[model samples]
Structures are given as structure tokens and as C-alpha cells.
Target: MGLRRLAATGVAVAMGGALVCGCGPLGADGASGSSASADAAARALIAEASLSFRYVGDSHVDETMNQQLEIKNATRGSVAPVLAFTALDKNHQEMPQVAVTTVYGSDRGGLVVPYGTSWDTLRFSGPGEHDVADVRVTVRSAAAARIPAGMHDVKTQALDSQGHEISRFERFSAVRLTNEDDFPVSVRIAYILWDQPPKGTTQQAVEVTSVGGLTEVPAHGTSVVQVSADAAAAVARNSNGPAVSIKAYNSQ
Candidate 1:
């Protein structure tokens, strides 16, 4: 199935008859069927141009509350949202030393899907005695938007044969320069060879091949170029190179 822009997102919590009304009911097993289904329900509310959430399900790990929240980005553009879980004490007041764990399905903080691609699992650390009073999810433009107003930067996640997502720790990856402004922009990418840089100093890596001169990332859209296997191998040779760099041209 394709993606759909949301118009409204909701939360419904139910634990063996104890219910907190909204969205779909949480099954007795505390598993909400599938993240994709929950994400679709939350995406129904995306046209509101705000950050919304749907409480899919909840579980207890070592007495800690683990909430499965579907964060819906209802804006026209991408949103980077920060989520926090607030626990209330016996006195109905806030508590300290609270820890919130976020496991993302998208690029690790690269850019939240403009309309939410999947659900984010949030594990709130500490005892459930301090009931969770609130789950705050706030948004801002993705880091790519802060790139000097004309340029855009993004990190790519490599996937293995099994389609398992890979991170920078595993190996070199690719980048896509997008044009999200009102005006048009030109974009290109290249691979840099940094096979073992000298320690303790900043030095430019040797420039390899560049894929440039033609690709234009249209306004309000994006263009993608895969990193050649040679590029990955080159970066693998280096103990420090991040692999490839993105270039943009004719940027307004």
C-alpha cells in the first residue's frame, strides 16, 4: 500500500477493562496488532499541521512503562519531533530521574516522515507507581532545513540483503540532497577516499568520482543517487571516512 496524509490522530488505552478512551482499543495482550495499522489510524489526523499521537499499546518491563506511540506529523513538510514521558508521583506531582527511550524506524533522527511512516516505541524508565500523566511530542523543522537556507543534508541508512536497516557503524552509506524551498536548486553527490587519516588533525579526504552536472532536485521535491559499491569499499578501507559527501548546485 502507498502512503496517506493524516487528518486526525488519537489515543485509546485499555487494560483488561480499565479504559482511557480514544482511537482503537489496546488488546488484552498489550500488543496493538501491527505498527503499520496503528500508524495508518494516526495518519488520519495529519492535515492539522501539528504533531499528534496515538497510544497503540503499553507493556511493563521490569515494572517500567513501555508505550508504543505512533507520532503523526500532520504538516506539509517534514517534522522532527521530540517525545517525553512525564510520570506523576503519589502526591500527583512530577518526579525526577525519569528516562524515556525512543526507538525510531526512520533514519536515526535524520527526518521524521512528513506524515509519519511508522510507530515509535517509547520505553519510559522507572516504576509505574508514578503513573504517566503525560506524553509530550513537540516538533520542529528537520536538521536538513537548517542547512544555510539553500542547501540540504541528509544521512542514509544502508540495508542488508535481508532488508535489515544498517547504520554508519556498519559501513559507508549514501546521501540525497533535496530541494524543499519555493525556488529550484541543483544537487549532486560524490565519494571521498579517506583510507586511514592521520590522527589528531583535520585534513580533507582525497576526492574520488563525483556524480554531478545534470541532476536537479526540483523545488519541493527530492532526487536520489545510490553510492556505488566502489565508494563503500573505499570508505571501508579508511578507519575514519564517513564515505560520501553531497553537493548542490544552482540552489536559490
Candidate 2:
């Protein structure tokens, strides 16, 4: 299905008033200081919505071959872009398997890209690795993009508080997210797997890969989200200390 169709039914957005910021006096531009700041932030988000993709080769498991597409979101806004992948055989013809699979971001499926400089790895897999000679990925502009809110209010920690396994797959693989607000919220989390601890505000890791997930948290409540087993394992094998980043935002 096209991204538009999936986005229509996939995204569950709560539309409300304009962005809530400081409500002080209006500035020379005839806008409130808070509103001006909000406007600048929004403009940054829209400008940085440009997404770049890098084909990182392919990996195989049994009879399937999985192609990797690394996506980077440079903006501080949440973007849900449509990702389409195709596999072609040596004959330059579409593989016998499904030619196209649409990866659309949604609240339920955890496809939204949250704020800050972030990278996400998307895998496209199909049968018969030998039949697949080439893989191609295409990215579509996000139909809806907005600066995420209440990001700093969301706190996260590894579920493995003790020397025990928190996830069914691995220890400390699941994340516990706490919402301090009085109302319910939708949470988007990105697990940045860094080969080394970051230095200052700069990303100092030699190797980094990110996995993201989304879920709903009740008012003054917390939620436990399980990271992808394969992705977590990959991180465990590569990183000494991985960081769990969380954000909460309301869409209009």
C-alpha cells in the first residue's frame, strides 16, 4: 500500500491548540517571545526534515537475505516518512517475492523518528539470498512533521535494576519509561547503541546503531517496552554502554 493510505489509517494524531510556550509580551515582530521561539523551533524542524539514506549492504540468515537502510533525521521534530524497498534479481527483474513493502511510521508500530540527531536501521528481508542481486530503497517526504514536546520530561532506565534479566531475550534489554505528567502521553524511544560512551554532547562512538519503539503511558504512570531482540543483541555484542533516549510528543 502507498504511504498515504497507510498514513491515513496508521497515524493516530491528537490535534489541539497551537504550541504551548511562554505567554509573555509580544516582541518587535508582533509575536510573543515564547511564540517567536516556538516559531524558530518549528522552522528548524521543517528545514531539517530532509532525510538521507545509506545502503549498508545486506546480511543473510538461513534462506532469507535482509537489506539494511540507515535513515538519519537531523531535525528536532518528529517525522514519519514512507520507506519503500525493492529486490531485483540478476536478470534486472523484480524478485519472485513481494517486490515492495511499505514501512510507514505509526504510533502503534513505533516508526516515528523523534528529535535530535538520530539514526534508524530498517531491515528488508526476503527469501532466497542468491535470487536477490540488488536491493534499492526509496524515501518519501513525511506527510506530517512537527516539533516534539515534553521530551525532557520523559525519563528512562534499563529494566534490569538488579542482576537479573528484564527482557525475555536478554538482560537489561527492556526499557522502563516514566511519564511525570498529569495526563496520558504517547512515548517514542530510540535506543542508541554506541560502541563507547559518548564524550560531552558530541557522539563519540566508533560505531552506532539505533532502534526505536513507541507506546502509550498513562498519567503519572510508567510503561515497559521491549527492544528488538536482534537489535539489542547486536548492540550488546558491539557496545560497552548503550544509551536509551526517550521523547513524548503530541501531534496535531
Candidate 3:
């Protein structure tokens, strides 16, 4: 069936349940059944779309090196997906010619796919019902250090075999400098420092605050907090970079 027709049919089936929700005599059971059917239809619709993109790894910066992009074809049909990575300076200007690599599959190769595949790999078969593509881009010292140092935005786009854009991913990174004395530091200080758990992750709220460190700093001593290197790179690529407010308090 044509893509449009298939999509339309999926939508009709999905909405059929919604339409029957309040008008049917089946009552609660009918509503439940409709909801389930609608959910299944929606998943089918998503699969029919053939491709999805997601960003993985750390969004905060410290000293460790980690960053990744995951591209998946959830549809039963085969699909070829391409990824484009763009790095922006603090002012949001595109960085020219960044070196990027794409790989596929893990050590054991369970159809999970690897990273940095030559064009030949693109022709390989994906998982029966799903496939994943991982892309890793390294920012050399010049690019990493010149990232404009603050809050920055990173944008990624995924394209299909026909060169049609399928999905776009965007994320913000804030880089800041942190010290031990103050546990909950603001994001404006250095644009490269981050607390554990990240900002928007499931455990972010619980991790951003410092829980078991020395509460007080000496009058003339300096305390420190660890920052994620990846987070800093992200902030350097955006217009805002990262901002932090420094305040000094005297503990009696």
C-alpha cells in the first residue's frame, strides 16, 4: 500500500476507538478497549513512519568524554537513514567542517548495529522489526575550546535514503565552573560545570543538589565540584554558553 494510504488507514483505525469512547453502551469496558486499540494503532503508525532519532549520553560537562546519537527504524519495513551533525559557536554560528564518524554494532553483534559505517554498511539488513544507528562526532581541541564557552545549542537532523528529512533533535548545554564550598551552584559561573543526574533526566531533580559534601568552606580556602566535559562542549556551541553567580558567605 502507498505510504499515505497506509498512514490514513492507521489514523482512521486509531481514531475509531476515540469516537466510540463516549457514545457506546459498552461503557467502561468499551472505553478501555478503545483506548488499547488506539494505543496499538498509534504504535503501528509510528512504525510506518520508518525512522526516529534520539540523543544519548551525558548532557553535562565534567572531564569525561561521552556523547552519542541514536537513530532507529521501528517500522517492519527496511529503511536507510543518514545523520548530519552540526556544531554551533556561542553566538550560534555554524562551525565549519567538523570531523564526524558513524559506527554500527557492538562487540557481540546482536543486530544492535555499530557506529561509523562506510557507505557499504548502509546496505546491510537491519533487525527484523527494528534497527539502530549510532554516530559519534569528536570536537578537536580547537573546536572544543573555541566552543564559545557558555550556554549553547546543538541540532541534529536525520535523513532517509531518498534524502528526505525524517527527524530533528535539538538540545541545550550550560557550562559553568563550580567549587566545593557551595553545593548548589548557579549555571552562569563557567558554563562548563554540572551536578550529577543532568538537568532534565528522570533523576535530575535528586542529583543536581549536593547532598554529602562539606557544607562550609574555609574563609580563605577553595572547594570544588566536578563538571562534565560533554556538557561544556554543548554549552560552548550555543549562544548563551553558561552563566553562574558567585557569592561568598562567612560561616561563623
Could you say which candidate leads in TM-score? 2
Give one digit per residue, the lDDT tens place, for model 3 in 1-252: 000000000000001111111121233455546775565444434432443444333324442212233334333332222233333333434444433223321111111211221111111122210111222222110000101111111112223334444321112221112233212211111121222333332110110111122223222333333323643344334323232111121111
**Model-by-model lDDT, in order?**
0.39, 0.42, 0.24
Winner by TM-score between candidate 3 and candidate 1: 1
Question: In model 2, what lDDT does residue 72 have?
Answer: 54
Model 2 ranges off by over 4 Å: 1-49, 58-66, 88-110, 115-134, 146-167, 170-175, 178-222, 225-252
lDDT for each residue of candidate 2 in 136-245, tens digit (9 for 90 to 100):
54443243343243333466665554534343223455667688867656666544331221221111113223344556777788887765766576546643333322
Q: Give the lDDT ranking, best first.
A: 2, 1, 3
lDDT of 1 by residue, 1-252 (tens): 011111122252211111112344454456465754454344433322355565533332222113446555545555433334443333435545555454432213422444343354443456552244434443321221211223233222344435455543344355455566665544334343322223322122244445333355557776655555665565465424343323332211
After TM-score superposition, what is the CA distance of residue 160 in candidate 2 from its true location, in Å?
9.0
For candidate 2, give the lDDT of residue 213.
Answer: 51
lDDT of 3: 0.24
Cα lDDT for residue 25, model 3? 29
Ranked by TM-score from best down, the candidates are 2, 1, 3
**What lDDT score is found at residue 192 in candidate 2?**
34
- For lDDT, candidate 1 versus 3, the one ahead is 1
